[model samples]
Target: MASNVSDPAGARRPVIGLTTYLERATQGVWDVRASFLPQQYFDAVTASGGVAVLLPPQPAAQAAASVVLDGLDGLILTGGLDVQPELYGAARHPLTDPARADRDEWELALLAGARERGIPVFGICRGLQLINVAYGGTLHQHLPEALGTERYKIGGGVFAENTVDVDASTKLAGLIGAGPYGVHSYHHQGVDRLGEGLVVTARTDDGLVQAFEAPGDDYLVAVQWHPEENSADRRLFLGLVAAADAYAVSHRGVSA
Candidate 1:
């Protein structure tokens, strides 16, 4: 299993599974639906001292998710399309991306499996939204409409910047330190209602929930900003990787 794989430095690197995008992609003379994720995600995991594994959308089944997670010490729900509004009993907003039902279902299943197995999980952007919905929370659907500003998402591929204040007592605060911390932003929806058992760890000046985590000692952090975008500072990835390493140690004992 990947959790047992050692780096060239002879140190064990915990296996971390990262979810990817399922989209129509084109390269060279090929245009087809593809399961892919940004290289930055992979880089962050490895740079944080963990092995990265891309988990693309698969046939959504609890059994399948369980099987997949059995080999992983940590799980990351990467950023992507908006979660289906119907999951939270709301009509789809015009600004919401067309439902990527397959991805949603698969990722949701994976999340459930992660919870059942007590695997450390990190959610980024859409990953945050899905985690909220999975816990019976609702989304604002469109932040511009809800907040009446385009600040959260300045169009174009460029990412906007925002500062969020972290609660001084949360684990996130301990990891990233107290703030008013700057972060990369590019999302149209925000958490409208916090999910059950989820503790709000950070928020922006506009009162949008920017970071949260399920209540536990085991890592389960979710941030709305794109940490992978800023490779210069990988505190979030490092936190997850550290928790993953601990999990790997406890689960299977340190691999030789």
Candidate 2:
């Protein structure tokens, strides 16, 4: 076990545990169905001065998810498959892809655990949806039927560029700066009903829920856009690492 002491270099780097994708993937010399994630997330965390750790899904993962979070400084719910509508008490839409139940089950557990531990959490895309569901919220299963356009998602494995209007009074406005900001979006579902203690911090011209934060002020902020996709401005990742650093300093004077 690591000691409860700070190293000048190592201690400053907060350990951010990122959720991974349990799906089929192909790479250089190997192709297999397993736990994986796009490196963009890890890269963002690393570039922002944090050590990225993978939180892989396994049997009984959720049962002990909170315990695992105790060892982490921060958590990033990365973008992935659609969440199960049944979990949110809604029927699935025709164009909606089948929900990744295994991922959903494990992530919900992680969310419950993280919230219990008061871990700093940043959710991106699917991650945002999961956060909403975890708080007893409903989802707009398909945007096309709801909005009459696929503007939010360009499909064919591409992200659409859009603008967001920020709520000036929210904490998110302080981090990313407000008003008519450009963002990268690639989702067909969005928050249809408000979650417990969640405040809408940003949205698009179409009035879809673009960003939200739980009001307790514990570094809990999630955006429908992918900040990891934009490498240049990494205030979101920086914010998470900074909060994790503070969490480490205030908790046990140690960092994973």
Candidate 3:
């Protein structure tokens, strides 16, 4: 465990856990060293006055979760490959590029454990989808086929901007404001059936679900956008880190 650092006012800084990915090849031999995530993720969290820690890919690895959860104030589920559909009782699509099943299982366990313990969580892109499926929800599998439109592209290009309508009265709306905001979209899968205790908080112009949140919770937010790609969009990390800071202050009696 790392030492807890106090802010200038003597409040303990929140520790934010960010998920990672595994590097696998089409052929044989998986190299563990190949795993990586962009540093902007850490920069975002740290910039928001939170300490960032990388949660390595260890699916079905509950021990890893326990270790990471301890001494951490929040969890951020970062983006990655498509989750294996079988975990959520669905068949894999032909286009599905399966991510690490073990890592998925571990993260799901981590999410369940975190919620039970009142830890704040921020899910982005694939992270959002994973959280939904873990809680008895399903995904579209392939957005283009499901939506019958190509207005949203999920691959191969620089980040593109799109608008997301915010649901007033939701934490997301409070953070980003009541009107539409430009967001970066880059996913083929989206929430098809919302999970229990979850509510849609934002959507694209085409009516695709862009974000959701756990009602009444201060920090369980999931969005299908890459805010880290655009730090100028400070609302994304600010909202999450602020909630996390509050959680830490309330539970641990430390100021953020």
Candidate 4:
């Protein structure tokens, strides 16, 4: 596989595709649109010398994944609605918010294809939960009921700060450094059982899962917070872009 080297003639920046959300308008119609991510997300990726592409919700998984995988150097699944429990062979919980079925299928397919092709992946908030479910893991659906903590809120208000203990040996620790840093939290669901090949690297003071990384091989990571909401937290995006750049240099574009 030839490396998809950014042609030096033109400032070739690695392209990263960010998953989007679907919204129902007042007109009583569901529209597929690219949700606004904090400006910090773009700044973070741009700071790392990567091009950020906002990916809109696609209707089909195979077609969507093909197009996304072809042009992207990496995939970043942004936070959004809850995932359908039916995806993992479980009944839908009464408290579980309606899932975005289309987004779920598309992202799961995208993540699976990325894994098979060695494409780098970064999962944030709902993205983390999606990765876990896509990889045979389950989510708590509603965090407060499962974890017994109202400390984390996801109601579109100002983000609340929380402490996350980092594992000294993990890549995440290397990125954010040791000790508990203030993280912005805004999610109602969390990983209940981890996906295969993923090891927890960070946890909340209350023992809730905060972050995880791919063990042994692969540049895959998922976090339960919105690092993009903080422009100051460039390390998270840098780490992801760096991994994608390395992977792009290694695998390039050999279609599977």
Candidate 5:
């Protein structure tokens, strides 16, 4: 295999695919469905020595996912709308975001293909929920209702701050340490049932599953908080980039 990314000055910059949101947006004189991601995501990747590739919702197909992953070293399931309840055999929560069937199908396919290819993956917020659901786990749908508190989410597009305790035995603790770690959060749903083959790496005081990792050598970590929101801490991003770099080296692709 050859490097599939451009190598300038003989430096290796792993190509990381960050999933994006496909939503209706408005510009000057236009308002239509568009694909977009926050700049912080790509910035975190590039800052951590990896190239960021925005992967928007596309026609859900295993073949499409395979083709997309063929050129990438890692995959990121980003934060966004809630995962449809039907995905995990649940009913709709009145507060859950409207169904994003296309995104749901597309991301699930990408995750499956990425795992099969032994590619590193990182999930944030909604990403974590999706990963859990992918592994036969379930979500709480509404944290306020389940937890009986609005600590995880505040109104007016504000991010709440929370603390998570990492398990010393898990891989996550190795990266960020095993203790009370402060994090930025803006989500209402969280893991309900532990996913098969997934280890719980962290949790909040309320016993909400805050983080988990898959059982494998390949990098697979997911957290309920929004790490991207806190630009000061890029350890999570760096971990993914480091894994992706190794992946690119072991599984070389065509380099331009």
Candidate 6:
């Protein structure tokens, strides 16, 4: 296979598609029907030596998802709206946000195709929950109700600082730098049942499922916290970029 050298570093930057939220967004003057993604997600990808592409919900995820996957080296299932309880055969929790059916449909298609292709993938807060639901797992739906406290979700755009017990055997621990590192969290819904082929790699002081991965995959990570929320920590994003770079060598695409 031939390689494309379009980047300053003399190699094509890995194309990492980051899923977005379809929402009513406001800019300087007007509100618009937009596919919104936080700057942090983009910054993290770029800072880690990969190109970030925002992927929005389409009319038919099943039809377009494979085409989208064919053009990327990696995927980032980002954080956003709650996963509809019905997705995992559960009753709707009163506190859970109404389902974003379009996003659910689109992202799940992307995930299915990516998994089939062995594409590297990373999942953040809501992303983690979606991963669980994707693999026949369940979510707590509401941590406050289950734990009787809002420790996992301290609102006001605040990032809670908590320690996670990382398993030394997992890739997450090696990439996380130090042991028992404090992470930024913002969700209440957490992984309850272990997804098929998924193993726990990290946990919180309260024993919440903080991170997981597919054991034999080159790169497949899901975290209950938000690494993109804090730009300072580039470890997770760097890991994705590294995996994506390797993926590109095998699944070549146009230079980003």
**Model 1: worst 10 consecutive residues (lDDT sum):** 1-10
Q: Judging by lDDT against the true structure, name the best candidate.
A: 1
Best by TM-score: 1
Q: After superposition, how far is residue 97 of candidate 4 from its true place, in Å?
A: 1.8
Q: What is the Å distance of residue 19 in model 3 from its true position? A: 0.5
TM-score of every candidate? 0.96, 0.92, 0.90, 0.87, 0.95, 0.94
Candidate 6 Cα lDDT to native = 0.86
- Best-to-worst order by lDDT is 1, 5, 6, 2, 3, 4
Name the candidate, 3 or 5, with the larger TM-score value: 5
Query: Which residue window of length 10 is worst by lDDT in model 2?
Result: 1-10
* lDDT score of residue 179 within candidate 4: 73
Q: Worst 10-residue stretch by lDDT in candidate 3?
A: 23-32
1-256, model 2: which lDDT tens digit per residue?
A: 3212334753467788899877777889988987798999999999988888898776787666856777787899999878888988887777778868778888888888877777789999999999999899998988998889899899898889999999997878988888888899999999999788899999998899999998875878999998888999899899888887777766645534
lDDT of 5 by residue, 73-164 (tens): 88999998899999999999888899988889989999999988889999999999999999999999888889999998896889999999
Candidate 3, residues 1-256: lDDT per residue as tens digits?
3334667887667788888876543446644455567888899998887888887767447776776677778899998888888878888899787557767887887897788778899999999999999878998888879988655564576676788999899888888887788888777788888888889999987788899999775579999988888877677788877777777777776644
- Candidate 2: give its CA RMSD in angstroms: 2.4
Weakest 10 consecutive residues, lDDT, candidate 4? 25-34
Clashing pairs in 3: 11-255, 59-102, 59-103, 60-106
Instruction: Tell me how candidate 4 scores on lDDT.
Output: 0.80
- Candidate 4: list runs displaced more than 4 Å: 1-10, 24-38, 154-156, 253-256
- C-alpha lDDT score of every prediction, in listed order: 0.89, 0.85, 0.81, 0.80, 0.88, 0.86
Write candidate 1's Cα lDDT for 1-256 as tens digits: 4455786878888899999877789999999989789899999999999889988888746667888898999999999889999999998888889988888998999999888777899999999999999999999998888999988889898899999999987889988997789999999999998999999999998899999988777678999999999989999999998888888777767753
Q: How many angstroms is residue 194 displaced in model 5 relative to the true structure, after the best TM-score fit?
A: 1.0
After superposition, candidate 1 runs with Cα above 4 Å error? none
